[model samples]
Target chain A: MSLEIRNLHARIAANGTEILRGLDLTVEAGKVHAIMGPNGSGKSTLSKVLGGHPDYEVTEGEVLLDGVNILGMEPDVRSRAGLFLAFQYPMEIPGVSNANFLRAALQARLPEGEELEATDYYARLYEKMDMLEMDRKFTARSVNDGFSGGEKKRNEILQMLMLEPRYAILDETDSGLDIDALKIVSHGVNAMRGPERGFLVITHYQRLLDYIVPDVVHVLVGGRIEHTGGKELALELEAKGYDWIKDDIAQAVSA
Target chain B: MNATIEAPIETVSEENDSLMTTGPDFASHPEAFRARQRAAWEKFVSLPMPARTDETWRFADVKSLSIAPYTRAEVVDDGDRAALLKKSIGIVETSGRMVFANDCLLARDIYNDTLRAKGVLWLPMEQAIAEQAELIEKHFMRESGVLGSAKFAALHESQVKAGTFLYVPRGVEIALPVETFHWLSGEGASVFPHTLIIAEENAKVTLVDYFQSAGDDAGFACGVNDIVVGNGARVTYVAVQDWNRKTLAFHLNNTTVARDASALALRLNLGGSRVRDEAVSRLRGPGGRSDMLSVSAAEDDQIFDQRTLQIHEAPNTSSDLLYKNSLNDKARTIFTGLIRVDEGAHKTDAYQKVRNLLLSDEAEANSAPGLEIEADDVRCTHGATSGQVDMEEIFYLQSRGIPLRLAHQLVTFGFLNEVIERLPGEPLQQKLRELLHGKLG
Candidate 1:
């Protein structure tokens, strides 16, 4: 089974400017796929569209998680259907404690009238927080309010660990992270990897690949996938930049 | 079972007999107190109801200010009293507590003996008037409180019977907060509750007043509280007003701070069909400070009209006021506040901020913040803002699987918590948070 997107086309709902143009990708359940792209290549927009953000309209596309289409579902419904997106810029929910926020999110997954056991919930939360090296006080603090850049990213990973979605998308999770924070965040994501889950790591540079190495790397340019290779492709792009691939795509289009 | 057992027979007008339950202790009260009550009743009758044309009643639902259909509270039955006593459990660790139902005292528990021995006096208003008449008279409703509720204030003074009277002597500090609960129980019944706090120089104390209804009954509540802070004293006061949705209520407060003394007052308005709240703080001494805070979670057709005034009467004094409101359904809220720096009160610092989070498109919020400055080099800032919950914030929660309704509530709670967190003491904060959660949910 795999998470697959086929011939996806989307546009900005406000201005009708197309962002995703016939994008196609597949992430096998047991593999980690990385999408490396230049600026304005629809990296973040793809994640938002996949999450069912209202700002973007899918003109034509079908997203299948384990052979069931989720394109018609609401954002929250998509999440309950096993799709999770790690936002590039996590929102700051003032006055909502991280513990309560995570609890509510987890509680939403339960069947009606089924109460979440508080003792076990806190136990699992503490364990996951410890794995992330998060201080105990973070749970009591407002969700992402006044959090440092690295701390917010770590909080995103912390939530991913708790929710444990079937198909997870990391949308530029490496931006604004220092070297040390990068390693810690990578560790958290790495700990979640297994044969039952799939990951789509979207990023601009290849530095993140060094820690969470990908099984396959795809070059996305002009809102379309232009090249596909193994993990070494990330190193080559980092050394050569995106110009070489853009030139190749230009020549291919002309030919 | 005459509800007006304490009302004097001679002074009870036919109209008032149907409208008010005077305290049972009124006949035995000192002549001076009785005379003042009689005069207040006359004043209440003479004063006209606030009209929409009145500046103080601007944007208010003046039609709903009718108290003619409500009568004074009657004595609750034993069973009702027991239930209310059980529900009166608030903060776990209070130094003293007094529970009242239908203007009658049900339970009085003072847990700390050391405080009792330290010349700390906490007694019912009637008992305090009997035992400390001069002391109660000195600070009882000293301010006219002319913030659009003068008629209600007069009505409260005319029929008020039982409340909390706290007197903290100089050099005595109560380590724990004192608590009082006023519960109104009856259909079409009304209650006049009063609280007078006097903190002596160099003393410290905290007090919490809870105005709750025993049930969801349409009633009327007119209450008043006056706080006097002496020099070098610290006082924190919080009033949690959770009357039922069918109730019409008025809560008026006047606080005076002396040199080097600081006072903090927080009001949480959760329930009421129509609630008018007026708060005034006067910094009468240099180096004094006052923090005025309020949080209201109004829903359905509830209306919360709050007016406030901060008077900087002395140089170097400071006052900060923050009021937050969250409205849902067709609920409405109005906030009007003024910070006035009196002449010769140089170096005064004052701030006023009001924030409204409208959760529904039909919900409405109106705000007016003003400053009247007569002194030079004084710092004053006032602002009011109305905004809906951020869609991005909602999306963030939904992306994590939280349903839309639940996500909206969590964000609203967070918006109001900014004011709740400013109060000191964790246990109290936890209790307030729990109460807020229940109301929002």
Candidate 2:
């Protein structure tokens, strides 16, 4: 089983500016693939387009999740179909408690007329929260309101763990994180990796790759993968820079 | 209960054609009180109904000012009366309580003789006039509230038969709230509910009034509240207006704070077809403070018109007014408030804020917040904001798999809880929370 993207083309819905141009990628279950790109490389656009954000329009693309096309599904529907996108900037929902928000999300996944078991829900929630080192009081606070950067990332991981999606995309999850917080977040992400799930990690810095080593490293440029190699490619790109990959692509295209 | 009215023949004739509850027994009240009621009737007859042109009546539906459809309410049958009493269950614990249905007393509870021995007077209005005549005459209907509802206030004075009177002596503190429940039953029934509170120097007390309709019947409600806070005294008043969706209501309030005294008031609106509420808080002495707060959750074609005034008449006095409304399903709300700091009232601090959360595209909210600061060295700020549910927040919840409808409700309730949390006591806050939830759900 895999999440296969075939010749994906997308643009900004508001201004009709192209971002993702003819991109192809495949992420197989049981493996963690890391996409390294510089600023304005449309890396973030890929995650948002896959999640059906209203601001992006997928003009030509086929997203097959285990051979089932999910291009037309709404974000919430796609979420229930085992596709999760851990937001780079988690929104702050004032007045809604974290515990209640999580409960509603979980409740929506239940069958019709069936209610969620409050005891079981809270038990599992606390267990995941403990893994993330969250305070018990955090459950009563508004979702993401007044949260620190690292805390928001950790909360995202908590959500990912609770949702238990078949495929997950973590976008810039290491940005704005201190060393201690980075290790904690990475540990949580590592704990969730298993043979039954696929992970696509997108980051700009090689610092995060050291902790959560990628099984395959793909260098993305101009909305397409320009180079692919095993984990050693990460060290090569760390030594040289994204500009070196850009030159290589230009030369190959000109030839 | 008996009452007497000795108004001119012309006024009585007009009342006979339009009034419904004025039986001959209605004139059985004390002579002194009867004289006042007669004068009020004459005034009510002379005054004309407020027109939309009146500044206080701006955005008000003047066409609904007809009084011909309603007459005085009669006592319900025993079966209905028992049910009405059962429906009158308020907060479980109170220092005292009085329940009235259709202008008739169904039940009452008061503290023991020890309370009366300590110079605390908690009695029905009819009885209070006979026993505590001196205090009643001093503070009864002291001011014709200036919030554009003087005509309705006059009508309340002329026909008011159901009310409560509370008087606390110097240095006496009643730790618990005293409650009054006024319920209306039967179609085309009308009620005039009133509450008068007097707090002597250094006394502290809390009072709450509940106005509810017994059934899904069309009715009319005209009510008023008068509170006088003495030096260093503390008084709080909470009014919960939950009539049936088919009723029209007019409620007026006047509060005066003395030297170093503080007064706090809150009004919550959950029901009624159309409601006009007016409140005036006057900081009459130095070091006095007033906190006026309100919350309204309107849905399904409901209209709530709110008007308020905070007058700082003395130096070093302060007043704050905050009103929050959540509108859904084509409901509408209007808020017009002003803060007037008098000349020479230096060092005054006054604030007026109105927040409206719109949940439906068709719902409407209007706000006019103004300030006239004549004093120097004073601080005043006024602001009104109208907003919808943040879509980003909604998307965040939806990304977690929560549906859109539930996400909207969660954000709206969160907007309202901020106001309910401002209430001082736990029981009142909890009671209001439950009421809000029941109405919203």
**lDDT (10s digit) by residue, model 1, range B305-382:** 999999999999999999999999999999989999999999999999999999889999999999999999999999
Residue-level lDDT of model 1, residues A1-255, one tens digit each, is: 899999899999999999989999999997999999999999999999999999999999889999999999888999999999999999999999999999999999999999999999999999998988999999889999999999999999999999999999999999999999999999998998999999999999899999999999998988788899999999999999999999998898899
* lDDT of candidate 2 over B321-356, digit per residue (tens): 989999999999999999999999999999999999
Q: How would you encode candidate 2's per-residue C-alpha lDDT over A1-255 as one tens digit per residue?
A: 999999999999999998998888899998899999889999999998888888899999799999988889877888888988899999887766788788888889999999999999999999999988889999877788899998899899999989999999999999989999998889888998999999999999889999898899988888888889898998888889899999988899899
DockQ, 0 to 1 scale, candidate 1: 0.87
Worst 10 residues of 2 chain B by lDDT: B1-10
Kindly give the stretch of ten consecutive residues in candidate 1 chain A with the minimal lDDT sum: A218-227
lDDT, candidate 1, equals: 0.91
Lowest summed lDDT over 10 consecutive residues: which window, candidate 1 chain B?
B3-12
Top DockQ prediction, candidate number:
1
- Candidate 1: residue B156 Cα off by (Å): 1.1
Please give the distance, in angstroms, between residue B378's alpha carbon in candidate 2 and its true position after superposition.
Answer: 1.2
Predictions in order: lDDT: 0.91, 0.86
